[model samples]
Target: MAEIIGVIEQLWRYPVKSTGGERLDSVEVDERGLAGDRLYAVRDGSGRFGSGKNTRRFRRMDGLLRLSSRLGHRLDGPELFDPLGRPVADPDAFLRAYLQRPDVALAREDAVSHLDQLPVSVLTTATLDWVRRAAPSAVVDERRFRPNILLRTPPDTPPFVEDGWFGREARGSARSGARLTFVRASERCAMTTVAQPGLPHAPEILKAIAQAHDGRLDALAEIAMPGRLGVGDTLSLV
Candidate 1:
């Protein structure tokens, strides 16, 4: 049997797709997922999911934007944060300042207001290594997958293999005492290929995974219960 080794080393949540994510020391889990995960997304005037897929058409949505939770810094509350952590105007005003487009900002606000759930995504270290081995030239990181949790595991394990834990409870260290279950493996998209500052040649890495791994590279998990997760938490395969 594989032994329980370590706790979650990293925790991340992308309030908005294609933008920068927020790192947390610990978070609570619910049926949907880490609170405030993927709560809002940017859409075009046509209502299609906007992202780096059509950078030229959606250039304003390309770069990284910051986010915060509206519910008192707790994961259980709504995820509504200013990109810069400053109290700014409504979503439109803030986005207009950051993205430089009143039209785009208004569209984003409209899309976000109707969202039913947060878009919190998670990943594991094992999965990242798998991609790195397959595509040595490709740069793989949380930015590419945009996951909420980045759990560390044995060096030899494959990335996202623990996703089998979906529907099962995983208990870990005191900091990450929350219950977790594997949900699904995140699907790769063209965004993986986009080049950003401090990260170059990323698309090749994701492409390599698709060519080698049947178009899957990372996994997503849901929190069965709300709890704190931190570095050094012991992960037991219960």
Candidate 2:
């Protein structure tokens, strides 16, 4: 039997790839992911997917941008905001501020006509510990695997156990509930190898997780429904 352990504390969503993300007090989850999460992404002139993945070829996407649901909408069309919360009237202008090289800028200007959207991504503390233990030397920070939900669980549990939480709803004090379904454990990628502040040596961490888990240790969960989640939310394994 699975056990109820902890509650969610922080919730985040990155509207754009590689750029910073927006923190939320509460978020509604639908099949895709946290509402307003990854609803848009920048595309290259060729209509191919573009982001930090190809930022070098499109440097203008280097600067920070944000995405959020419009006041009366359900995340079908989110709004873009600068890191300061100011509105960005022109997408081209926003791209220009971040893209530095002329060739990359024009390529982005031509290729990235709009933002790309992805399904939601979730994470938890238990998963982090598993990664830490497996790779004691790697720096595993949240930034490496940007997720929509950051759940706080018991100290010693495995990280991706939430994947086994399918058919269970994590209930909270207010009528907020999160239905968990075990998606396949996320696969590690070069992105996990990037060095960031807090995590100076990331490759080692990725290596540890991969070694411990047979080369499959990217911790992410897919949510069936999104609702308000709080610190003390009851994790009902049913």
Candidate 3:
């Protein structure tokens, strides 16, 4: 039996890839990750998706990082927020103006919507705390890492413990039937080092991970058993 590790500390959903996401007190977790997570993305003129990972195709990947989005509870599509935190009624118009590239348009996620390695990404506060030691001044917002679930480990847990979570089976609420099979360690990328709204430029973040943790910060997981998840749900590392 896996020990009762921790309860989820934070939940996040990225309506658009590479763009900032919305924080939630609770969320319905599904096999495809979170509901409406990475559901929308900005496509460039060539019909290629915009992502910080694919800078060659979308040279303005970092540009997309400036904006943020949340689900439109009352609207059919996502509600966008500009750099200054002002609501943008028109995302395409905002993208065109913000990116200064009229050729770009917002595209919803399909088969190609998965820009990352796994469906769900998991991280622990202990790991983040461990990472903070590398550069104390830089902002270490969980948003920068873009994880689906942020589990709060025990107060006594050591930092970077999530690295050991790899290749493990994590069980959640029995009603929700959630069990995540940790596939592999999520390697840090350039996106983590970028300076965004609340985060200052911290290039050393990646260097710290590479040097201190072998460039691994989180774990990518696949749903072994589908179930609902919410804040405060106890997760067992089986």
Candidate 4:
């Protein structure tokens, strides 16, 4: 038997890694993850992917967040837009100019994965509500967390509900019948506090998470069954 926990509230796809993304009403989930998600990334001369923080595979490049991407068609790659939403004729050139690094270019992910952690990141409204209560003054938005799937739980559901979802699986109550295993809780990072176009630089967002939630929020998932997912699909735990 499966228990209904929530309805899918939002679907997000990041065509380019470390950049702002587009919201969709419905999307296809595959073995790689949400289609078009992190399919492209800005690669530097040294081959590090652009990100908000430094890592073995990523280099700190906050300028990437100022841009956004939209997937036009599956046959072609996604298009990059400037902060004002104007299309860039040469994404690679624009990245080099914007970041003042001529060696950087927009490249597709190859053998190396562009994802910071797991394939899919999930967040719940219950946890968002809890963050709001924790930091009554700071701006709290789901975009900061960059979740691929945002689930809206019942109104009375307690905060941090996703904490208990690790190792469990969610089956979509839709024709596609997508299934996902909650692999683990997603750890917090400096990326959450990085300022984007509409979002401000709020370090306190991470501070609240560390203090209240042990420096973790939401969950990372992997596709157990690949299929389509929509905003209204119900995710049931098995």
> Which candidate number would show the highest TM-score if scored against the true structure?
4
Model 2 lDDT tens row, 1-238: 5456567667776554455566777766766666655445555454444454453333233333232223223444445565556666765455655554222221222333332223544467878767767766676666667766667777777666756654444444448755655445566665566544344546676667667675554334456565656444655554
Error of 1 at 2 (Å): 9.4
Q: What lDDT tens digits, residue by residue, belong to model 3 across residues 92-188?
A: 9888888878898888766665456788888889888877777686778788789988999989798777667787899886766788888887788
Residues 131-174 of candidate 1 have per-residue lDDT tens digits of 77777877666666666667777777756575566555566665
Off by over 4 Å in 2: 52-91, 100-118, 133-137, 166-174, 196-201, 218-226
TM-scores for all candidates? Answer: 0.70, 0.67, 0.92, 0.97
Q: What ranking emerges by lDDT with the best candidate at the front?
A: 4, 3, 1, 2
lDDT score of model 1?
A: 0.58
Ranking by TM-score: 4, 3, 1, 2
Better of 1 and 3 by TM-score: 3
Q: What CA RMSD would you report for each candidate?
A: 5.2, 5.9, 2.0, 1.0
* CA lDDT, every model vs. true structure: 0.58, 0.54, 0.80, 0.89
TM-score of the candidate numbered 1?
A: 0.70
lDDT of model 3 at position 70: 89
Best by lDDT: 4
Any idea what lDDT model 4 has?
0.89
Error of 4 at 211 (Å): 0.4
